[model samples]
Target: MELKQETQTYEMPHLLTYYECDETGHPSMSMLLSMISMASDEHSMALGMGIEKVQATGGTWVVSGYEGQLAEQQPVFGETIILGTRAVAYNRFFAVREFWITDKEHNIEYARIKAIFVFMNLKTRRMESIPAALIEPFRSPIVKRIPRLKRPQKLNENAPIVEKDYRVRYFDLDANHHVNNARYFDWLLDPLGRNFLKTHRLKKFNLQYLQEVRDGEKIDSKVNKLIENQKITCHQISSDNQIDAIAEIEWY
Candidate 1:
């Protein structure tokens, strides 16, 4: 019943509805995260660890952190895409998973993500060791030896950089009622503008959430291009500059 590292490939049909683009029409960041979630579900189902089975075991998977970067040109709506995922590695408390969004033609990679996950005892809301049965199916040895990603940089209190404002909306709240974690990506990346967004696909990403964003509040987003390789971005939902989230993205 020990969990194993595994890899799975899935074909994701492009849904036009997901292209709720911004002022510049393209796939939105929120929709990209949603598609990644769907791909994760499909990967789990393929390994026979679908939601029903996890619920039956009285435990569930929870995302701890995620890092992803966007490629400049995302496939427009109605384009067929392929989403692939693999169980990279895991330790006692943390599991690492990798995913990619690619064109159906296999010529381009639109996005890539690395995420950390933890198992929770649904009743107690406490972290639990992942069961062997749940992981064995993944069949990935990469998880065993994979190194931890670097933590994102913190903002300096003395040299503060103020950025644009993001207003929370009703739909931004998920079942948990806080701002949906993925929405932060919009605030984090939008400052770069359409040109930067269109020219580069996310080659690597590292993110950490320090706090939460609530409904109806205005949040500020800041970015620092520390070296071309390390792009640091942060989000705070207050004028006082308390960080609600932070992300580091690397472009290819």
Candidate 2:
């Protein structure tokens, strides 16, 4: 079926807090992703598809991947920003959602991101068809083909790469009983070190999740050493002898 030109949207105002920001006093990439995620949950709740309702179908929504661009000028702690999201389109197995963060007046966009989500069976821990009762309330069109996001480039394994290992902690899990999608950003970028992160700002990023990272797992995050003239970096996260996720980021 063809989707409508207009889709349901939801927006809310959020006040940035000190904890959400880094040393630059601006919201960090991980926290920025979390804010938009919060908006998505609120959107679902407004449509009467809260966690309880969705979980009743024996499955929950999982973010498969995200692609986004960040404005050079970002919102700082103590600033009020608007978080907005819309149900773009969906198929039986995948749904695309768009999100944005802007000043309260909506004059300047701080970040714009699009995420692809899949319904996953909690018990089986595998992909499942999205139930109509959980998704139809948003009124997004059902399409035979859901548009795919740009894929991130893979890293050169033989190249000089920096790697850091982190153990999955209890706090990393969200209500879905899986690692929170936003936490991956911290692992992906941390290998770049403090100096680089403080000096550069992210312009664009694409993150693809190839496998799930479970609790107590010791995961290795690796990134190619930055080239002097190149502003792009490739990252990979691996655990249990498998590549769990990969990301490509462009910096300013």
In order, what lDDT does every prediction score? 0.68, 0.90
Best by TM-score: 2
Cα TM-score per model: 0.72, 0.96
For candidate 1, what is the TM-score? Answer: 0.72
Separately for all candidates shown, the number of backbone clashes (residues 3 or more apart, or on different chains) is 28, 0
Regions more than 4 Å wrong, model 1: 1-7, 16-18, 142-145, 163-170, 175-179, 187-204, 210-243, 250-252
**Candidate 2 residue spans exceeding 4 A from truth:** 1-7
Give one digit per residue, the lDDT tens place, for model 1 in 1-252.
112332334445455453455444556766777678777777788678888798687887777778776677777766677776777778777778887778877689888888887887877767898877887677655345546666775655455454678788999887644567788888888777666676655556677766557788888877643334434444333424677777766665
Model 2 quality (TM-score): 0.96
| All candidates: CA RMSD (Å) | 5.0, 3.1
Task: For residues 1-252, write the lDDT of model 2, one tens digit per residue.
Answer: 112225688888899999999988999888988999999999998877889988888988889999999999999899999999989889999999999999988899989999999999989989999998888888888999988989999998889989999999999998777788789988998899998989999999999999999999999999988878679999999999899999999988
Candidate 2 lDDT for residue 176: 72
